[model samples]
Target: MNENKEYFVNEEDFIVSKTDVKGRITYCNQPFLKIVGATQEQLLHKPHNIIRHPDMPR
Candidate 1:
């Protein structure tokens, strides 16, 4: 991971919440929340890519 990167939450499981620069619940699915073990509030502050699993190619 990039040490310079900063985020409200970390990508651990399957919570891939995509949001714009502003904090808003733009996109999210049931599987995302369930696998990550997080609520909507958690991703609200976090970035859209916080849930981007490492397996995803750059």
Candidate 2:
């Protein structure tokens, strides 16, 4: 089953990621990886949208 949950980041926490011109993930910081529950190996070269929230506007 698909589960919906909310994750809150700390006020001082900063999430950072970078994508290629084609929108493929190139780099992501540790905080971003933790929030997305993915590893560098899993996210690298993948589409940035792979971690987009459903409620987010396209």
Please report the candidate that would top TM-score against the real structure.
2
Tens digits of per-residue lDDT for model 1, 1-58:
6578666754554545666666555766677788777777777656655665899964
Model 2 error, position 57 (Å) = 2.5
Q: Where does the lowest 10-residue lDDT sum fall in candidate 2?
A: 8-17
Candidate 2, residue 15: lDDT: 91
Q: Which candidate has the top score in lDDT?
A: 2
Summed backbone clashes in each candidate are: 0, 0
TM-score, structure 2 vs. true: 0.72
Cα error of candidate 1 at position 49, Å? 0.9
Model 2, residue 13: C-alpha shift (Å)? 3.8
Q: How does each model score on TM-score? A: 0.42, 0.72
The lDDT, on a scale of 0 to 1, for candidate 1 is 0.66
